[model samples]
Target: MNNNVKASINAVIVSAVFGAVQVANAAFIEDSKLTLGMRNFYYDNDNREGGADQREWAQSFKLDYSSGFTEGFIGFGVDMQSLVGIHLDGGKGYHPDSNTFTPSDSDGSATQEWSSFGATAKARISQTEFRVGNTLTPSLPILIATDSRLQPQTFGGAMFTSKEIDNLMITGGQLERAKGRASTNSTGLSVPGGTEESNHFRFAGADWKVTKDLMLQFYYANLEDFYTQHFFGLIHIQPLGERQSFKTDLRYFKSSSDGKNGEPGYRFNNNGGYAKNPGEVDNTTAIAMFTYTFQSHSLMVGHQRVSDDGSLVWLSQANVVNGSGRNEGEGGISFYSFTDAMIGNFARAGENTTFGQYTYDFADAGISGLKASISYLRGEDIKAVSGSGPDLHEVETDLRIDYVVPEGPLKGFGTTLRHGVYRGGGTSIDDQDQTRLIFNYTYSFF
Candidate 1:
């Protein structure tokens, strides 16, 4: 079918799914078994040099309902979500600023507002459960569902999770589409900014508890053409006597071309965009991070290195199907912000990085629900010419204090602040500084 025809069909499908959700709520969801939640965010992003700045306010509403059980060991339930966004400080020039939202007009800018919502049907039998529709599935290499906004991103597909085996939990899923935080239009997931041709995606994984404080995970995902990745993770916690614990997290990723750009994709070729890039390659990466916690304080450190290739290919942004998409997110494997997320930002070609971080929990200090953290990521010997570049150096610092009102109508409101700077590379315009301030409040009703 033609591009326009396909787009029209996709839109129709979306409407039908949405309509089905509403019908289910009215006909099947029991009022007495209903639960509701809402989250509101006030966000601001400022850029000093360019005329580009962002200000936005958003609210997300979630509804959950289930009928106790169908008079047997088998039970059924449904999950629903409704999201909305309001334009606070963004305009036309900030077209890309709309990210997950709608694109700009002919003048090249962002739209004022947008929103999307979805629902799912689920069944449970013992320790195994299955669900279909909008849900968060962080199944390692396959899908890293992000939650960096007022509402978390979700995948439109079906998933099965079970813990029937002793000390072992198994998961697998087939996701056909995904919904970003800013937009309600679900799109077929591509690599970075890839095509939406292929609608079939699969993943399977297992997590096992080796001991009281030790766990291991294995996952594999085939993202058709863009790349196929395998992930291995180990987490261990060692108590340093009473009131102290040392945490260790280790991860390994191996990825290569799949499908078209992959050995399977019909479009696979050596003359493609990925083939010409210097550092693009089928390679692996390993990371080891450790944390020490003591009396409301913690310190963390880690090291990461790219394998033989000049540039990291599989990790670059691209269309999962077209293999020539965009990296809308931060790009690269960033180590700056939180030690947990390695999202946004990209490492220069042939680069190796070292990072460290520290966090303080102020609850014991009588500041309940308040905490602060900071981290640094440094990468040197980046590619410049033919696997050579002007090396990369970046630093990011963030401070946030949240106070959930102990007694008030807005008892769960809080605030946050973030700042960061990056330098080096030849992908886009040189280096830049970024900052964000957010005030948020969330509540739930059952």
Candidate 2:
């Protein structure tokens, strides 16, 4: 049988097996949770600097099932997710050039429908848990999964998390491959400008709560043949008054080239910015932020700086498929940084970004489930790889509003609207405007 046919049969078998096991084991049935989710997504991006516009609309569904561990010193359980996406709008003129929303067909057209299924088997013992299979492993400072499109990305991997030590949490994992949000195919890992593929991504991290209001974290990651990275973070919160508080956050990352990074298949693109040593990775980045929260209002300000050697390090596969050009399908990425904005990420060699945000929650005004926020970011002093040029600069502004139905039949329904404007100077940077409208609802069947 074909792979798709086999996958379908396996899904059916898994559903039946889980259903039977639930009925056989009272713990499994009693603790299991099943949820069905629906999402209506509309996206539009206008490149003011001259490029084809990207626009698309789609409807998606997700079926998630998670069972509790059975009784024993080493209990076992299972988790499954089935995802489906259907094209709702966007014809030839509005098809995506970045392939950010929909997968491309053999004729370079959007597919009518796509689906994916994944399952993870887990075991728990003495406050630690082990999970294996297709998993959405928790997001880490080193590898943040992309979930901006119709279906969240999933990776084929195994991970272990432990909270056995008081006031501390530890995590470690090995991931082999990833399925993008828009495509049903799973692909090996690689960075931008890379032609070779790597199936191994290893990482370990720990978070220690030093005090009631202070926490410290350290993490290390190695992407085979790409690079190795170390991250450090600190967060502290202090009570100012009955309804006021102060918060501080600091983050740092140090990265260096790994085996084969400068080889033919593992080269770095330098991403328009200058790399002190082309094709090799070497960079340091730091960010600090302070926030004040009073009642329903919050104000935050932060600054980030990247070392002069290379662009900040993160997993990006923008050029891995279809030979490092535009119109390739299934490209999206995410990172754990304050400068990771909706329209752009202000991370480049010698770049400095200053940003701030203001937010208000309507709960204090008797409007529960309603909130709004606005943010602005300015980046400058970006170094060019050519070693001779004026410094580049950019600015981005974003506005967001979120609302969830508080009661009635649509009590659980939610709506989110976001708009972003970006203007910059550089070969890689572009002036653009983007908007997203999303409606989502989740129903439980348990």
Candidate 3:
């Protein structure tokens, strides 16, 4: 075993022993979970220019224990998580240039696999809780948790959540570093490379419910020297019929250079627009998506517009939009970077895309855990749009299948297959048929 492996095991053992002691001393063990899974991908990058097929395996474990108030006004608790990954296939040639999903070996070849385990101390009062250590933070308009791979991305930070007010939720946090999806190594926030400092990412947000079917959200984040983002969102769910519902998601984001807008202590729109100041880019984006569901069939369509001089803040929890996840080409059409990034950065100045998708659940047909969907998006005036110039159009489609064991030790076992096709203008060095095959049997031990 290497030093990294040794350290991971040691950490898990230490947390286990510590939890055991707490249990022996009468602490309540509230929750515990374990999941082992694998994801295999038959990927083609740069439109068949490069292809790598491999099966990646990951194992995850989590345990939580909360104590009753000791001083009546104060409460305490502990949370622990252990994550490990193993390389089933794909060598260095298969790995991407960025270090978001997996790690690189010292020999330049693919390392067998890596693991990371972490624990956090918790404190609570009335309806507010504070936690310190490493965990999963899926902040929209900024950092998002990616679970399309065998493992999920994690973060090391201190977070505070409060529910003192009625019908409103407030969240705030300060993150120091981010742990990649497949490796134990943690990194500071950056656009893609390790060229920036670690203490650059910070965020805060609030969500309020206006009515039973209406909700609103606001968020702010700073990526240090890179950029700062502000987001606003609205969601409404309405029942159309006995078994039909319509959901509307409207989101807007304004982004600009922060701390260093080409100068220290100066942050604004200095890039002037996309590709103009390729050295430093910024912009604002808005999206309004509407989905209607009836029985097991659903249809969704939306229009997204990226204004000049601001960057689109992709998110997960609430702000960032979905549907763009199953693009086929590495850059041509789709944008599914959350789980497995095929479109690393899908942004261009003054770009606008009209998107539509259709989905069906096989459960209505008496099949469970089986779903299928197809989507298409056409973008215009991307990268360089001069009032009425050339337009870029992209089309993408996907087919997926999922199956899980219903009972026994393999109860949580399941698999997923995703295939896509992307095409359009200014593909940015990416085009071709791409397929990712992920099959994993999850085992839950509580």
Quote each prediction's TM-score: 0.77, 0.92, 0.77
Tens-digit per-residue lDDT, 1-446, candidate 1: 99999999999999988886666554444432554555555555544446456555555555544443332366667676666555554544443533543323334354355556577887778989888887654535435666666556677788899999989999998877766554455566555334334566778899899998999999887766556778898999999987799999988877676655532223322212123332233656677889999989999988776564433433222233212233232222212113333222433334466787888888898977778887777655544444333443444344445455555676766767666555533433234555555566554453
Clashes of 1: 31
Overall lDDT per candidate, in order of appearance: 0.58, 0.86, 0.58
Each model's Cα RMSD: 11.3, 8.2, 10.8
Task: Summarize candidate 2's per-residue lDDT along 1-446 as a digit string, tens digits.
Answer: 99999999999999988886665487766899999999999999998978888888999999999998886577889999998999888867788555678877665667789888899999999899999988565688888887877778788889999999999999999888877777777777777777677888899999999999999999999999999999999999999999999999999999999999988889987666789888889999999999999999999999999999998878755344554343334477788987889888888889999999999999989999999999999999998668778988889999999999999989989999999999988748679999999999999999
- Taking all chains together, the TM-score of candidate 2 against the true structure is 0.92
Residue-level lDDT of model 3, residues 1-446, one tens digit each, is: 99999999999999998876675445334333344444443343345444443333323333332333223356666666666555555544665533334454654444566766777777778888888877745545445665655566666788888899998888888777666564565555544211334454678888899898999999888766666778888999999888899999988877765555444222222212243444353667778889999999999898788776543533211011114322111111112221122332335566677777788888878877777877666666665433245655445555566676556666656666666666646545345565666666544444
Q: Judged by TM-score relative to the true structure, which candidate is superior, 2 or 3?
A: 2
Which 10 residues in a row give candidate 2 its minimum summed lDDT? 321-330
> lDDT (0-100) at residue 341 of candidate 3?
27
Off by over 4 Å in 3: 1-27, 30-46, 49-72, 91-101, 139-141, 263-273, 313-345, 385-391, 406-409
lDDT of 1 at 9: 99
